[model samples]
Target chain A: MSDIDVAMARALLLARRGPSSDPNPRVGCVVLDDAGEVVGEGWHEGAGSPHAEVAALARAGTAAHGGTAVVTLEPCGHTGRTGPCTAALITAGVARVVFARPDANPDAAGGAQRLRAAGIHVSQIEDLGLRTEADALVARWQQAQDLGRPVVTWKFASTLDGRGAAADGTSQWITGAPARQDVHDLRADADTILVGTGTAWTDDPRLTVRDRRGADRPQQPRRAVMGLRGLRPGSVLERTGATVLDTRCPHEALRRLWALGSRHVWLEGGATLAAVFWQARLVDHVVAYVAPAFLGLGAPAVADLGIGSIDAIARLRLDDVTRLGDDLRLMLTPTPDPTEGA
Target chain B: MSDIDVAMARALLLARRGPSSDPNPRVGCVVLDDAGEVVGEGWHEGAGSPHAEVAALARAGTAAHGGTAVVTLEPCGHTGRTGPCTAALITAGVARVVFARPDANPDAAGGAQRLRAAGIHVSQIEDLGLRTEADALVARWQQAQDLGRPVVTWKFASTLDGRGAAADGTSQWITGAPARQDVHDLRADADTILVGTGTAWTDDPRLTVRDRRGADRPQQPRRAVMGLRGLRPGSVLERTGATVLDTRCPHEALRRLWALGSRHVWLEGGATLAAVFWQARLVDHVVAYVAPAFLGLGAPAVADLGIGSIDAIARLRLDDVTRLGDDLRLMLTPTPDPTEGA
Candidate 1:
């Protein structure tokens, strides 16, 4: 992207934050007048706010006439968080609409059609950075919805053979300090980090962002334990400023969370909880980091979520596969419902 | 494990490999007399190469009397590839044995039991490096075998949002150079790098180790393309020394390739190929590297593998997970069989 667009994208990114947007992409839109000053500015903050276009038009207040509305996502044609974004844009009298990404969710994927149908000038920059930032949380949320849960990513580090820690739990560092810190940064983007009480009890991990720079540390996504009876006084979570979602009944817990506000969640494993989430169909992504080391043998395999047939499947389509530092990371998303096959 | 066992455990780790040695661990066994001279060394290469114990005993020859053998994995009692390893060890007259990790596979999970039953000085060393390595790979493999396929890991690098490539397809460097090299190393461990012809034709990535210092660089692994048809002479495969496996029939093709000497393979991505492997129950493990980035609206997805019911299932118990520098990697294997759920 050009320097101007990059700055514009980041600014728009900062504007979009969603409470209901957990697992949903946080999007923002801005309309620049012919002279390049901001004519209208709006963002999708939390779930039920007026979408970017509506908010931008409302903020523009007659100044939107003949101005080009630069949007992060194609204006929505459906009434979701609010009314049709395309209609909003047209009613606001914007001369043209410049969008970085099209509405990706099928429900929202038709924004471009609606805008063009309304006879407004619609131009898609097809900028990648814009769309990527636009859909981070929402896309994963979409996958989770389509496939029945969140995208499950198993992140771990192992030796040449995949191992997390040595037997006896003396695993202080395997990949290196840098790699551990890398995880901290990752935790920042996650909506929540789901670890079993066992792991929290064993490691006493603070479960908060550390080993990074700037006050812009992780968003402090919610922290959770699998079982109902693991919260303790001396636990790592004792004073960590985070919410603990008890997921003994993960499906219901996730539903509660989704209803309240939770977009993505990370499963810190010990088998039982991983299985819980798996069975509950709550795990959205699986990030397994096989450290180039081993723990001889200790913890049990993440408990089985009782997946009987492939049909009771909590599906994840392998989206993109790559290698981390001496590790492999797999990206996953849910299979769409209709396409999930009857 | 105890501190005394850590050293021995590290030594045992040399044996483990990626998922697939189901019911059997990748093992390394060392035999020495009371004097502890390098009497013999053996690792589980795959099916039917002298089992580690037998190989070690055979190499020990007549000097096997009154010796202590340190093994990465516990010696077996039942026979799979050869006669019971415990029986062989006893017949060889070894006096004592030290194992870093106990055999978890049911067939050999009782190796320690058998060794103890034989009245030998058998010791289980805690904190064995071998344990961790074995756990990571075996968990997924066992899961896959039990569930009928390998694990699934998705690796993709985009924005924090989960975008893969830009709209215009200008994916020059989504990740840094080090990150790219890291991917090659991961591929090295893999038997194949499965991808669609679209990726092959577009970037013409060598898909081989360009960096020499990495392990995968020394001895390159196979590059197996999914849609291995319709190649132009000047295409990437034309110059790149890689194999093109037809995904039209994933199972049959894999079997054919196995017949053609493919011991392990890497499944590169292309939606069709991923879908085929996933649907056909051939994917044994999925190593996904997810970059904290996103690309909106590129390709629909990597796979639409025509999966119908969960009953067409190939499920995996979440095995090992970790974070790789600014990215997440998930190493997954299929769920293990009920009879031998490790």
Candidate 2:
């Protein structure tokens, strides 16, 4: 097999890893013989498991000796879940290593450096397509590592006129069933569903993942209630099992959630809470669902972010625009302002 | 010629009409001989001009006899600025009449019916593609004829948070230059720009079409001020050409504008005025420009539209969504409520 064949094999092995990898990057490895024939293949299943290279080396046995290791991500040089993959490759007597994307995690980065120092031929795959594909698989984990907290995704559904509810506070349904199902799909990707105490207590929502037919999902995200306000004993969130954090500060709540192993936080808080996170520049992503209907007067999707003038207004980089039923779903990320000294 | 060939020829002839053909539907015509050879072609130049079919017939002369007349729109039976196109085709001894779109204007729609009654072979082109193209060319005029009033397109530019102005009314430029330039292009298509007394007296905007370089357009729309408030001395609109209407009712103002030969009206009024037109269902279309900025506290793009509940909220059919600079422009048309007995 050629280099292209090895890269294709690595990509296939990477995709074999299911959507269960969290906190750690999803990586795949393939051991190739001297003639570039794939001998063994393995992928990182989840956290607290053997790294891809180590798993592949164990399967390859003596066949891994003098073999080239083709991987989606750079093998880790540090010990976290299992031993460092670099040491494992070296112990297995691998002759060469070819990886797609460079590991951005500071702790796990120096794998190529270690391999080269050990006289193993190490090459970073320069294919832009393969690198982009590998990077996207670990984008959320990389974001969490860079921010030192769970990546926050604020999801909101509102009327086309920007109203979250009617004048009389009737907001039982703003988006259609399709958009609601999309929200559930979004929640499935997150490990934690966060809401302010005001929402948890006032709306008393059961923040549980459910399908369009109202059937509970097999994998459910933990419900988290932030802010100083306390939840009532018989509240829906309290009864449905929620972690109550008595802090109004967004950073503190995010720190606690990160400590609880949450890599992605889905924020379903009210407008005021969203504004607080937005003003603090803690929101990583924004997902807005705009219904075709117009309620001229009602609660706004975002309120009072301390923006007084045009220059102070926040800007977001639009990523995707999709239509679901009669509603539009906009995916955006906050554009970092250079003036803010980020 | 084949129907496809004639349809394509008619489309090209329609495209020959200049952009200044306002207050009237642009139309094109072609005459084909018995041997499928093109005899003559013509397009409506502007308002007060001879209809396309008449001009084509005059050019064809005796060649039009026993030939087929192919037109973008069903030839008119009622005369406006010139003689009826139906009478011209009959006098020219045309054997068959084939048109792309049926004339929606009640006053001019009886041409096909009369041609059929005269024992002439008449057929409406059933090609959906050609009909759609022809209908789009005269969409606003057809809408005006259907509603018995000038087509109202409410265009408003706002911050991404749906604010028209800051709390202190400092909204000089919410969107960037590109979006503002796009708005001027939109204004150039309308014959009149309507605003309420509040907007006229407060903002005092010079409602004129200008290019990005601030050069005035050759054709400027009439700035119309509705409502009873008197304009201050030396107001911008008063100094620039403007028409003052005492009635605040959107329907009455539209009717008066229609009688003045205005076919399309761009409403640049304030939120209250916009709500009035929206609630009355007088707004035929909406052009919203959402800037990627946030003004936490400010005037909303629209205010209290007499809707208290979610079910009563107005629904608009979205037509186009485009990004102009950092602004998102949404083009929507008001969907008539069946309950209102359209």
lDDT of each: 0.57, 0.80
Ten-residue region with minimum lDDT total, candidate 1 chain B: B306-315
Candidate 1, A67-94: lDDT as tens digits: 7788766777663533367778778777
Q: TM-score of each candidate?
A: 0.43, 0.87
Model 1, retained fraction of real contacts? Answer: 0.00
Best by TM-score: 2
What is every candidate's C-alpha DockQ against the true complex, given to 2 decimals? 0.02, 0.61
TM-score of 2: 0.87
Off by over 4 Å in 2: A1-21, A30-42, A56-69, A79-83, A93-96, A116-121, A211-213, A338-342, B1-24, B30-47, B53-70, B79-83, B86-98, B104-128, B336-342
Question: Which residue pairs clash in candidate 2?
Answer: none
